[model samples]
Target: AFKLNYSFEGISRTKPEQNLSGSSKKLTKDVLLQKTHEERRKRQEQRLKLQSAELLQSHIRSYIVRKHKKDQERQLFDEIETTAGIQVILSKLLFFYYPKEDRERLLRIAERLLNIQADVIQQINADKSFAWLIKRFLLLCLKNTKDNQDSMVLMKCLYVFTVDAHTFSYLVSKDYYGHLKRLLESSNNYLQETIVLIQKPFKFIHESDYLSNLVLSEFCTNFLIPSLTHNVKHILVPYIRNQRKEFPFEKLIRYLNTGFHFGKSHSLLYCTLELEPDDYEPNSDSIQVLSKLSANLYELKPTCDLTVEDSDDEEEEDPVSTEKRLLLSEYLKILNRSDKVRKWINFFLKHNHDESVLMAFTNLCHNLLLVYKDSMRKYLLLYKFGLSSTYLKRLWAYLNKNNTGQFETKISSFIAWREYHTTLSVFCDMFTFYTETLTDSETSDTSHTFTQNDLLSMSKLLKNVARGLIEVAFPMCRSSSIPSTPEVQHLYRACLNCVRMLYTLDLRKKFCPSGFWTSDKMHIPPDLARKDYLSKKISSFYGARNEEDEHLPPLSTIEQRSLAILEELPFLVNFNTRFLLLRDLCRNSLGEDDYQRLHHDLMHENVVAIRRTHIYEDAFDKISQKS
Candidate 1:
């Protein structure tokens, strides 16, 4: 059991086991202190490394951000100095009304600012309050300057912004289009560019709304109607296809379907808003030639003025060379090659032959009709071959023949009829001109007048033109009733006038004393006829020029044929009303005051109708004045 050993100083003596335990406790405490100190030192070193890394990273990040900022600033400064530069320093100084002593410098800077119109606009937008000031300065500079380069630049910039989808509304709100229109009037050459700009915004806005309606109205009346020469299908068709809402295409079609009236209305209706292109009639010599013809037609050569040499020259040269003339078929084939026109035609065919498409084609044909007579030959040939429907008919038959009423076939038929009508009018004009020229031979020397061959050639041309017109007009007449519509009535009236003119010319040729030499009843004296045997032979040849009998029956015989033609034509409901008006005018001509007053009233009414039909006449005048 246990006994304890003790030392004499009242201190207890430790046993061997206790001594060992005390040493062990001291060693354990020392080891624990060492471990804790090591742990604390390692933790301190780790925290210092982490702090240093974080500081270095932050510095690098700050340097990168600053470098990027400096680079951006430098790039912007470079841009500011380039051709499309900002010139912000000059702008700000001008805005603050800096000294008058540096007026020259300021003016130079202002000019630069004006030169870069788009840049100036950007600068203006950057500081909204400065817009008015900048704009005023620009206006003042424009007013004081005569050079148009700056003005054109300004217009170009505005147009550029107007076509941008993001900026269109802002530009419109700022009346950029209005300003462009004003500038356009001042400068006549930018019409095409203006139209392009005007059409660009349409693609983005095709819905029903007030803005869209306004845009449409402006496009139709101001841009479309006024620009007669350009084909708008390219500019408008794509947008129309995309649009969900119905546009005013029907209204436009109805208006264009009507015939053009004469006088100022004709001039206005034919006004082309397109700028003269570089390739357009570059030869100035054509004008001189045309003027010479006009002068010669009005000039009266004295009798016995014809020298033998002059007669020889006239005989050698036909005076009218038909070289370089494109036939209608050739012209149409060339037109068909145009990618845009082909696409439009294909689009129409795919769309089930819409009337608007037909109208567009007719309008194109109408413009072709208005071309100079040399070009008129192209249309004539086109009617003969290109639109003969043989090629198109076969093409349709090969394709879905069930879709017989495709665009090509329909447009060809319409164009054929239109060309025939136009050609008939041309024939009537030529016939009248020849008749008058021949009749004038009695007053002038006969030797200098038109030869029998010339007269025969003219007659033959007229007969051919008449044959085509009748072929087209008769079938159309048979299909429709007489005078079914005003358009049809107008065609009937034109045909009637043509017939009357031809008949009058025929009678004059048969009975006129001037044409006695060519008359069938004239029994030439054998002696004189032998002495002038060459002249007699020429006269007899012309007299025997009855080759047109098969195609064109005699005009007197044409009476029954015309009656048959009229029977098929649409009946004119307003014919009796017009007859009564005419009767009243006839009575008024006999010094009847009441009838004259009534005639005047009717004339005024007719003028009102003309004004209504020609809506652009008044606007055209205003446009002309502005230009």
Candidate 2:
């Protein structure tokens, strides 16, 4: 019984130990679970904080962008307000000062106001008082202004105001139409200014209201067209001739065509040209009319002179003089047409009296020759009418007489010099045409061919022209001489170009004879020839002589004269042309040493940088190699 009791005690003690170990393990597992929950809560808080920070940054960025845009808009509004305020103040001051004859202040104000015309025009439309002040001031200035300067200022102000549609409408409503019309009529003395004023309103035509269109039509019929008709020669002709930027011919035609009354009859008045009739052909009747007009223009004296009473009776009989005017206008129009000009020129060339008439004809032909160029070539060729030589002879004779002081007025000298220049230019054109025709004949089947007689005549004419030009015009081409007047300078340059062209043509050997370069009347001095021979021998010894020197003849007058002209008047020919001339002379008249010396001098003397490679040089080299 005692043994059984001890075993039960041992079993009970072991059971208690096992229960304590289980309790310890359960306590450790509970602590691990608490630690894991704490870690998960910390991670959630971190993630929420990161999202909040990004949201805050994006909101702040958007707020900044909105603020920047608002600030820029506000700044722009303030600038615009300030500009508008400045324009108003300037306009007010301009109005206040203009009536007091403050010309200087007015000009300063007008110029400043003109620069901001956009704002000023806007103000003129929005503010009735401002518009009234500007309109009244402009009218007063236009009405009372006697000074050209004041008129120009007023014109600028009016031009600016008229270009804006609203301001133009406002001005028209306030009796400005009559004042503007009167302003145009009164300002006829200032043709260009009147034109400027007249053209501005036309710019608004497409976008203009009906009243504005009516006003523009009135301005055109009552003022613009009439003034243009009366002064077409004085104003429109010069404008067209000069190619002025102020008013172009095409724009004027378009403006005139906008008028309801503008027809083919009025077309002649504006452009001094007529619509080419669809059925109109170049017939003998038209030629006869042109020939009659030419006879009248070239007549030294009128066929009959009418007394005052007779003239009145004739005027009463003719009433409008429409036929005479139409005939004269047609004559003037034909002078500009290349196709008709040939016939006109032929008629003019047939008659030869009166220096003034000849001068006019020469000028006309020169312009035609210049403008028509190769188109008029066949009519003026050497073998054809020989008109170029005829014109040149007449001009030279007139010039010779003028040189003797027979006609020494400033106007006479002016016309004579111009005639001479034009004659030379005409000759150059003809010669170029001739050479081109010759080249074309060789390459293609051309109808016109030059004969030996034509060549001989051309060469003789060239020699005479060259000699005369060198003696008369080239003396002024010297660099050391005092600078000549523009007229003289123009004449000199024309002469130089003509001579150079002639020399170039002469080199072909078809136009000029072999002996043309040599003159029997001119002989070189012994000393100069000997010096030249010795220098050439030395050059040959020093390996400076080229194979081209073996068969070269002695220098002649023509060669000497050409060389002297080129050497003495270097300023006349540009470097490239001079270089080519020298090269040609080297191959023909000059020795190799002379060419090298001149070439070296040319290279050194020129101020502009010379390109080492040239198209001309390449072409010349190719031609030389091919030959």
Candidate 3:
């Protein structure tokens, strides 16, 4: 019985152990599935967050773009409204206002409004009453001013009328000659405004045949010449009566100069003289008037001997005398075909020994020299070539004789500097003519040929001019005591550019020896070279100097100053010369590492690739109208 009970207990224990193993396996599977579900949920939340952030960024960008577009539209609409308001007010003032005083006052307000917004002028069109307003302004210019204030308002209105292209067109199309002639005849505060009106047609004459004919025939013949002769007689009559008042010299001179300038353009001077009837002969009265005026001008004492220094301080320019000279000079430009003008020229030529007459002749010739090509053949016929050449040489001698001195005063220095600059300008124009002639001869068929003697004469003149320029520039560059005012510097720079122009024309080769421009012999003094070298070496060893040092005037050492001068002289150096100069200048300055790196970059870089991207992007621009 005991053996049977032991067997049953062992069987029960085996069954319980098997059940525990099955339950543990089930728990392990459940835990693995729950961990997988948590990871999937987290991934889904991350994707949603990323999408929301992207949407928010897009919304911000769109809002900014819309705001900018709306602002631009608003600004444009505002400009349109403002323009419309201005146009309406101007129209009312011009059309509805009948009283002169009311019209003038309203015009001033309109002008101020126009000034406040420049776009109002630009937006003005001929289709509007602005055209009528322009005509009204021009008619007002004809009437005498009540006061200086009235004259100024009229002048400002005329200027505003001219500022719009369409308004100017309308202003010029009308015939105000009858009115202008009256204004020219009368002495009033409207001289400036009248001159402004007269100049408008002259300015646009080249663009319109009607305008050109009007100026040459109606304006010059009836208004300008008659008025000029009348005013001169008026002034001279007063002088003869021992009521020696200041002649209206400036006014007369301005009128004559304006006419001369207009005539000088398009060979209209000859036309002006020829504008008279086929049987037109100077009346006895005109000849007598011109004769008396010429005699009075010639009798003025010689003032040419005034030294540059003395002239700057002591000799205030005699307006009467200077204007007299200028008037005589202008008469030289008149065609000799007219009996009165011919008599005037011959009278002055006979009295050429008179200091005033000679000065006038010189001044005219100097002006002619600068524009020689333009007036050369005409003047050659007028003076005969040899006489004209002699006049120019005599003028050159006179300029050189007076071109003296170390001036202590600013005014004197400026005066002396200007004279030198004029001398350089005259030569620059001469060289420019020479270059043009050569270029034309090479590029096209031409009848005129430059002789060897002509070339030699020009070369000699250029060298002499260059030497004079060097004399001026070298001292100014070397002297640290010279005032570096902008005007002085500008004159200096202009002089240097003239020299560079000479070099550009290949005239420098004839004058400046090749050895002169060598890098080693750049006109730097030995001490200056040493100082530059020492400064550079010290700078390299001590790292860069303070930023304040950079702002100091670059004209320190001769080499540094020369570099500064060269940098400013864009006219002097062409591309190849500029590159060579830069290379030579920077050669010893760059470090070996920097140089190598730059070289490597330049050699390895693909310029075409870099340029290609920009080229393709720019190839089909939607806004460009160009084919």
Candidate 4:
């Protein structure tokens, strides 16, 4: 504790002077005078040393006091529960609950204990010992709902590992999907965080590993589509759109539970429709990323013909019977927010003429026309000749004539193609909803009469959406030997519904309120156009040569299925939405405006509306309040 600048030699030399009193010093003065004169320099040095020693004593006391206080505080903290020796703590917390933040403190104090080198994180994912810890943490996160006390800490550890691409890709490449699936049981608060963390690596992953992608894709399909969370649809759509099928999907129907609300799933389809070029590029191993991307898209947004009519049990049961539905719906929301929908729609027009694919085209057009019919003339500009020509009756007839009807039957059976039929049903319902809502809203406020512009806008929007949908679905009606049970029914109803809402046959009355098209009969063209598009898509699916090159086709069965599935995306997406939209409309007790309000209410009730993906929150009621 001492702070003396003087050495021990200086202290010893000056010690002799300390015992002397003033009188004793005076007696020695005569004797010391002669000695002092002889050694004046040495006496001066010793005097200075004495003064410095006195100063050192004060500093020594201050140092001792500070050290004592620190030691006492340390002792008290040690006695407290958390700091109960590292050995006991490590043994207790190593499993079930690792305080990642506290572990960080250990590193801060001494880096060598864990022996974690800077390169350790990257290697840990591949290293057997460290990899086990990562897996253990992953499993722990999935043990309970997102709000579990230990869940957040586990997520933090995962986050640290993800900081490096090497570690992250390695972890993801392994079966992290098992843990991801477990998150479905977690509360909404934790679900959001868990999904966000998991989705990070997926943004860059090509899904080269079949087992890995299949497990992950299935997990996502189940969790994303039925989830009530709006964000989920947006998240999963990119994986589904503009691609063929590479992922296993024999259980797709089972996976997409009846609880799925398709109207809200549009964002997913849109996202699937848009393709990312980087995803299409080959990986370092020269594996084609496009095939995987395409396959996932097909599974996500199928245009092929297929349907799963609700069995007695499914029809009788409530969709909200379990938590799985909510999770799937949430995933769908994430997919929808992306551009996957349009990508699949465009792909169908180019590849197949299946009715389901046709329906998807109609559905996509319906969405666009409803939202942007003001630019119909401009839409016509974007509409390619290839798409239009495929729909043209003469062109459709020419294509079908070449087919012997065998391909037609089998092609028609494809689920993606069949989904187009469902799409028409969905739009019919949406149009119905829109009309009812507009009518009620217009009339509800009785004091305010329906304005001329409001009526025209409503009429125009409805008619345009119907016409756009018909342009894609009507051709199938013309081509059908036996008209579709619901596809044609919905298609006809949709067109008729528009007329009913508009209170006019001249469809231009909706767009041009002046009735200019009435005299010219311009509305016929849109109706005829719908019939042409439907016929062409149907003929294409049945008749088009699926082989881009018979000699060098898809490298594997997966690639072929993916390509085939993608060919049917437009229809699958459209039909699925239609089925959901119809079911919802039929089930809804409310009228149009009330129905809209109810839809709004349901979405607003979702807890993840504002929070991060994996942020687990209070139960349903508390989440609803926050939303």
Once all C-alphas are superposed, what RMSD does model 1 give against the true structure? 32.4
RMSD of 3: 29.5
Q: Better model by lDDT, 3 or 4?
A: 3
TM-score of each: 0.27, 0.28, 0.29, 0.31
Clash count for each candidate, listed in order shown: 10, 0, 0, 103
Candidate 1 per-residue C-alpha lDDT over 1-627 given as tens digits, one digit per residue, 9 for 90 to 100 = 899998687757676434644554345888999999999999999999999999999999998987676556545544564454344544443443323333344455565655766765675667654564555444333333223444455444444433223344444444544554454455555555654555555655444344554454454444444422223334333344344144333332222333222122211222211121223231222222212222211111122222346643545533222111222233344344444344434443553244333333433433443333333344343233222233223222222222233222122454455534433333333333333444454342112333445344434433333333333333333333222332333334444444454445444343223442222221212222111111211110011123422443222223322333323221211344334444544563456687678778887884533555455233322433224
Q: Mind giving the per-residue lDDT tens digits that candidate 2 earns over 454-526? A: 4455445544544444444323224323234433443444444545544554444345665563442332233
For candidate 3, lDDT tens digit of each residue in 377-450?
Answer: 44543243223334334444544455454422233354555544444444343334444454444442111333
lDDT, each prediction:
0.39, 0.47, 0.44, 0.40
Tell how far residue 534 is off in model 2, in angstroms: 21
- Output candidate 4 Cα RMSD: 33.5
Best by TM-score: 4
Model 4 — TM-score against the truth? 0.31
lDDT of 3 at 253: 30
Candidate 3: where are CA atoms >4 Å away? 1-424, 437-498, 507-521, 525-554, 557-561, 568-581, 584-594, 598-627
